[model samples]
Target: MSLLADNGKTSNCRPAFVCLLLFSLLQLPRPQYNLPFSVLALFLCGVVSLSLGQNDKAQRDRLIACLASLILVTALLQAMLGFVQALGLAPQTYGWVLFTPGASDVMGNFGQRNQLAQFLGWGAVSAAYLYATGRMGRAATGSAVLVLALMMSWTGARLPLAYGLGLALLAWFWHRRVPQDETVARMARVLAWSVLALALIQIFNQQIDSVLQAIGLPIHVQSGSDRLLDAGFGARRRIEWSKAWEVFLQHPWFGVGLGGYAWHSAWLEAYGGWPKVPESWLFTHSHNLIFQLLAETGLVGTLLVVGGLLCCLLPYFRRGEQTVDNLLLISIAMMLLGHSMFEYPLWYLPFLLMLVIICTLSPAKGWTVQLSGRFRQVLGVSAGVLALAYAATGILPYRQLIQNFTPRNENTLQASLDNAKRSLKLSELSRNPLWSWEADLGMVNYLQPDGIMRDLQLELAERVARYQPFPTVLIKLSILRALNGQAEPAKQALTMAIANYPDYTPVFQHELARYREPELKPLQEMASKAVKAGAAQGGATEAGRLAAVMTVAAPATRQPIF
Candidate 1:
């Protein structure tokens, strides 16, 4: 239990060093969207590690308890928020919670159901930790479990349920095999409670909904759980995973070069003749974490990251005993990692932070650095200051950019244009470079002029498409190209757009129909052909064939402009 013992060491260099190397990977990309998060993680690890190294066993336990409590409280608050949202007691807004509109989604502040479910699972685990360790009372633990179950059910995500059941079964088997490990028994019980809670919710979810409706409360329409057994439930993820695999194959070495999944997905669909995703759905990630890392960072990045984790965990492995603390922490870490296998949970900063903290806290004993008490104090203060500075310089500017670009009633056309320009300027100093492309795209939309300005808009659209490759941008770029009398390239862009969204031909035709320009006729003809092909073939096959033919006929240069 004594993290530092009488060794009087004030630092653990191995973890801090490994953590620094691991987080530094976040800065490998030009955009560095996760740079601010990386810095914050470093600061947190340094402070926590230093604090533990200076404490005795009792003090260390208290500090760890406090940290665990903080995580549990945050997760509990999110669960409560989700519960309220499920009951229609709060306004779901962009500034606060953004539940998917008209769906039975309850994401709290995480903005996605699966992510929220994983976070709530962390809460449930934390509650079990507190209860098994005699920190939380039985009643409080039960209430937390019940609330988490209801919220998890409302999210309508089934993967977490499966994860819970799987973990529970593993815990039971471990306990049975060991027979002497109290930690395994306690963990098994905790997982059993979670599994039971979720299973009960699934069984009675309809009754709960009916009761709420009968009580005159307006509940949002629920997505049926029957979809969990549907054959096509994960079809989208399969499509995205296939696209990500193709991207990895093409890049191989450094992969697509960080945060480039969307860009490459667009490029592949446009040029590689891949199957088109459903309209209105954009795959920002490959859904699976391993595939995403392979597509975005490739072999080198994945090895560095995976190797760093192994290095950090080596001490625990070498210890060879499953202590209660180790089991608890490993269970929590495994929940996140297991979820990563199915979905990109760690992409969000909070989940990433949790993983970092768990890693930092896991190693019981390691190479220690002895420092004077005064020196340790100075180090802690320096880390705090550095963390504050990084947040101010990086996160603040990013926040401002979001606010500026986010539409409000006062944001007129000119105001919106000015905000986009300002956002572009801010991106230079901000840690996030992705927003720069977004700002440029906004300018392309807000700028309304003729002649050279129109040409500038086309150029901007082309530039954004290289990085973002969003369907709308491709369509707009095609229209602009046609207006500029570049009919062939225009058709190529339209073909790529249609290829990415083959089933959306009617919508594409409608957009083209809105334009009175004679130059748009060919683009309309292409969309109409795709629609006819889709109708004749009855799905993706015929439409995909047409898109392939069109792509070959007007093949745009394969070289990426970015």
Candidate 2:
């Protein structure tokens, strides 16, 4: 079947405009998981609306197939790049494929190891769908499989690797729901063989590791573990989900405010005894999707989301016509739901975009529920205004930083300060305290004090601590107190910093401990200066003295600084 026919049946401006508005709400926050994602969402919103149109199931299905094909192609390419990098046969830094910080694992484009894994898993499913339905050739399918196995295993992303055994089961189950019994059989064999081939390596996992190591492609030790369930990736995630649940229980109806999880995490850990994860690890979302919605939007929103899913998915279970598109969508939907239990798949906009498309598509036309004509018009106009505002307000500060970026230290500092001030103004206009917090931090890091550096640091530290007493902020406050001659307050601040992040105290101690040796004389001298500046009785003083006296101190050595 052909895609995008010559005859124009409808103007999709209304739906497209409404989508733009829907996406604009996703922005309006700093350090956004990646602002470019928002742009992509907007473009996709327009394309999906204009191209797919309302009630055109065939076009929608074809589009989904084409997108799956694209995903397959991308997976093949990423696998190739990652394999080359892992083998040390090619440069790793080329393009967006950068080695993760501190770890040798390479991720393409996403910059995160886990995200790359999820994207690759999506690719794997996409390729599997293409081949199972006969849209993709055998040679292409085999090549895709080879690359996926190598890359997935090499990156050692826990979810994809450990969940290896589950993929085939998913494939068999989803394919059976379709009307074509032949396709179901084909899919079962294909998926079972593919999954089996990947799983076979486990029999000689050690030998495989040895071979890869010899060739410098050793699987990453951190993520490659076959350990099924991390008890939710250690206590950190356990505590995060725990707090979110407690918060949800209290506000079972409305839950906490949207975008209120982080603050509540801090509050719960502080007061509710919800088991904080060594203040070094801060949580943003609830980590679990259901619990997240429960804490943020309450049961009302959660039920609405659940109802929508039921609307989209219940049809598959009932006996009816089913196509390859329906099969792929259901598989992806299931994968996303399962992955969301351990990790948030929808937080990434690309995955989220795919999800929105798949979940919205049905044998029937239009969305599960349609907005009224007047509401659509109003939404369109409102969306346009909000989109423009979001783009202008958020991008302007970063634009200044980007455009004025200079190699010269003085120029860079001034440019940064300018952007900080600009961002501060935007914060005032938008009433988002995060912007102001960002501006103050920027000023502290870059601009000349002009005389109020102390005030700025103190106020910034106080303001930030009030919301979330992140160890970094506390450390800064401690430093400022020491420099300002408030020695007792400095010690108190330093104590709070260390006590708050017990896990990180060793790292902090290492930084101070470096000053003990003569080789670290510069740091030693600096510490001495800080101590002489009236921080004489604080942890800084003891650390400096110990660092100066101790000839061989390990960075991980812990002392009673806190």
- The TM-scores of all predictions, comma-separated, are 0.78, 0.67
**Per-residue alpha-carbon lDDT of candidate 2 for residues 479-509, written as tens digits (9 for 90 to 100):** 5565565666655555444433444454444
- C-alpha root-mean-square deviation, each candidate: 5.9, 9.0
Model 1 CA deviation exceeding 4 Å by range: 1-11, 19-60, 92-97, 173-187, 212-225, 271-277, 311-320, 364-437, 447-450, 454-459, 480-489, 501-521, 528-562
Clashing pairs in model 2? 516-547, 516-548
Q: Cα deviation in Å at residue 359, candidate 2?
A: 0.9
Q: Model 1, residue 160: what's the lDDT?
A: 70
Query: Candidate 2 regions off by >4 Å?
Result: 1-55, 88-95, 161-166, 174-180, 213-223, 227-233, 250-252, 274-279, 363-441, 444-470, 474-500, 503-562
* TM-score of model 1 (CA atoms): 0.78
lDDT of 1 by residue, 1-562 (tens): 4443334334555553555555454543443332344345555664655555445446656766776687689888998778767866556454466555555468888888888887777777777777768788878888888888777777877777676766575566456666786655775677688778878877788888888889987665343263478655666577677778878888776776556688677555566644433444456787888788788777776776777667655544443445545555666677788888778877776677666656666564456566555666666677778767766776765666565553333548986676656645544533345345556654444433235567877877777776666666777888889888999989878876776666566777787887777888989888877766666655556445555335323343332211
Candidate 1 versus truth, CA RMSD in Å, comes to 5.9
- What is the TM-score (0 to 1) of candidate 2? 0.67
lDDT of 2: 0.56
